[model samples]
Target: MNKLRIGAATAAVLLALGTAAWSLRASGAGHTDASAPAPSVLTVEVIVPQQQSWPQSVQASGSITPWQEIIVSPETGGLRIAELLVDVGAVVKRGQLLARLADDSLQADLRKQQAAVAQAQANLYQAMSNLQRARMVDGSGALSAQKMEEYRIAEATSRASLDSARADLDSTRLKLSQTRIVAVDDGVVSSKSGVLGNVVAAGTELYRLVRQGKVEWRPELDARQVSTVHTGQSARLTLPGGEQVAGQVRLVAPTLSATTGRATVYVSLPAGAARAGMFANGTIELGAQPALTLPQSAIVMRDGRAYVYLVGSGSQVTSRAVSTGRRHGDRIEVLSGVDASARVVASGGAFLSDGARVTVASVGSAS
Candidate 1:
């Protein structure tokens, strides 16, 4: 019975020892699994910087206006419009008759004035002969001094009346000449205010004249852009319907407009079929500028800020803030925050983190 109990106790002790050893091995395996390092993963591409040409530019918008405009008006009152010789849009030369006024009464008055002038001339000749006779009588003492002086005064008064009548006749003739409305310059009639039998007063507007065939394109540019525009600068204009016309800058405004913060730039187009009020768009060439340019894909924006990823040694990338200027075709001008020696990431910058490991691929290689 003692041997049996002793054998049972020994078997229990061996079983307990085996269980403890298994627990220790399991804990050791767990520790080994926990201590193992994680795998490092990164994918990247090589970047290079190159010099590129850039253009200095300023953008603006404006409307087209006429170069010259003239308003024609009637010069005399009580003139009835008889005939409109030229209609709106008719080309006319300087001093060409545009309209006629009913001057029948004026003509009658002119003829009466001419008859009066002839009668006055006859009176003037008679008065001169009487004056000479009166002077001769005064010298011969055949007339009293008072009577002779009175006769001489009468002759002088008659001469003065004749001269006054002649001047009045000439003035009436001049007024009759003005009854014909004439163009003061070579131009097209843009507007007409005349109608048959409509009486017009002096200075009543008759027609609006615009110089024919020549039109000016006046474009407004901002004050900052105005400085870059020079006389004779080449400009390309895009009209309605996508028609392109080339011209040169003929004039620039000397003062800036306080209301619009802009000034006018006049572009003189070549002779063609263009009207004064045609809508147009144009671009003027400013001078060129040197700039650090990079592909547009290399730039990224975050939190309303622009940045580019720069690759350093060991295939590491660092995010750098940048100031940008004008954008060209497929590239952007870097105003600051990048040097020619730094390698800017051209793609896949959104997935990158600072200090992350990376594998740099060559050009044309898959990322």
Candidate 2:
């Protein structure tokens, strides 16, 4: 009976030990699975804030236009256009012939005037000869006083006719020269309204030119913002196709727009493939400023508010609201609400929430 009791107690003890070992193994497995971070939670790119010298700029949108658009018109009327020498978008120099008119009728009038001048000269010679004979014979009564006076009048009348004919000839020559329409300044032809065989009138617009191939960026800004811009300030423009153009502020409008109450800012750009009437948005750099900035992709705009995710211990991310200012390209300046040393999820902040767990794929600084 004593042996049976001892064996039974030993078996019970062994069974208890086996159960405890099994529970320990199970607990270890459960702890390992619970502690391990899931692979599919979320991955994000992280960045640290950097100190940079960023340019202070004014932002606006406007059209690229000509510095000066000169309208070329006809000075002489009633002539058919015989030739077109330039087309739209053609580059031309000052005094370049842009078009020519038919000169057949003009030449005919010139010839007629020349013939009249010749006839007047011949008449003047005859009258002068008569006047001389009358004066010589006046000593005798053969030439009366009335006849000499008439000879004097005839000489004067012929001389007057000769002067008038010469004046007419000069007028005809001037008219003939006007048959050619020339450029008044070096420019690019922006528009051409005249056609071959079409008769144009005086004061009729034939071509519109962009004088000197110079372009300007005219941005309309509010009155408060316009005061910040001035001549000689440098600017940069970005086209829709992602091309960048540099320019300088040339003028600030003295008056405000009546409808929009916005002031105009004119920025002159260098000669290039930039065309007038191109719509572009750009910034006029006021100067460089010390700032803490981050990549634009790092900011998450929600409900009209901008937010960023700050990295915490154990790959946790916290939502942080930041004040942004002076944005350029893909980088944005942080005005406040973030520390310079804080590591932020540069991108994929939209996929994260406050205290969200994440795995960082890359770490860098966006200055």
Candidate 3:
């Protein structure tokens, strides 16, 4: 009876142990089902390249210069500059007095000329009276024919002397007018070389003027670029001080430079827009044409080449290398490599890799 009782107890213990082991296994399975992770899907935005009319342009760099520089010089020689009126950067009008030469000697010569003119007039009047009197007495036998002929000859001589004196007076007046130096055109004085009390020679440069105060940008371009540029095209430039200026193509060089193999394009800027001798970088607008372009944010640079991310089947992003061209605003031209049908990741491409699956938040919106 003791052995049977012990065997029954053992069987009951084994059953209890088996039941507890099964319960523990069930709890572990439930915990595992609750804690297992889901697969990751990166949220992103995608865009489709569109065909839009974008301006065609060429990048150019060159210098700002005067459209027409006028060298101001004195026409008369051997005169001292008595007064300096206009200086550098002075705005002047046509025929405005720029400087005055020492005119004390000229004034004296003018007074002497006036006296000679008066004397000439008196002599001419006397000659005319004598001639009239000689004609009246002719053939009246009041005077001999020889004496009448002599009087006529004297009158002619006096008339010639008066004419010569008058000519001298007119020449003196012209010299006096030259003492006052005047501007040849309306312009802004760019430089001044004349000084007060300095003697000047004929054709001596006194000042430099920017004709009409006009300036132009001369951009050097290669042969291929020069071929496309035409008069009347629009241009936009950035000045040295970061100022923006607008200009229009005035002329294209007729010939290319033999040394540099480049051509100069003249772009006329508005007055006060820029100054001569300023270095500028600018672009010439050729015109507009349809182009396949994507937002600049869609582009990525990798391994020194431009690339874009294209969303493929299964929402997977693939890296695509692209050839880019002109950029306008936030959009960049896709010269080749990608087409309009490809869906590109607008932004956050730096965070992604090839074959990466993404959950697109919105179309045509940046991440």
Error of 3 at 42 (Å): 3.1
**Which model is ahead, 1 or 3, in terms of lDDT?**
3
Write one digit per residue (lDDT tens) for candidate 2, span 145-252.
888999999999999999999999999999899888899999999998987898888888889999999999998999888988888999999977899989999999
Tens-place lDDT per residue, model 1, 1-367, is 9999999999999999999999999999999989865333456565655566666755544555555777887788988888888888888899999888888988898888889888887877887787788887677888888987777777787788888888988888888888888988888777887777889898888888876546667889887789889998878778777887777789999999999888988888764535767888778878677877777777888899888887777667789999998787887888889877777778777777776656767633111
Q: Is candidate 2 or candidate 3 better by TM-score?
A: 3
Report lDDT per candidate.
0.79, 0.89, 0.88
Predicted candidate 3 versus true structure: per-residue lDDT over 1-367, tens digit per residue: 9999999999999999999999999999999988964343578887888888888899999999999988887778889988889889999999999888887887898898889878877887887798788788677888888888777887888788888888888888888899888988999999998877889998888899999999999999999999999999999999999999999999999999999999999999999999999999999999999988888888998889999998887788899999998787888889999887788888889888988888888887221
lDDT of 2 at 189: 96
Predicted model with the maximum TM-score: 3
Lowest-sum lDDT 10-residue window in model 1: 358-367
Candidate 2, 183: how far from true, in Å? 2.2
TM-score of each: 0.71, 0.65, 0.77
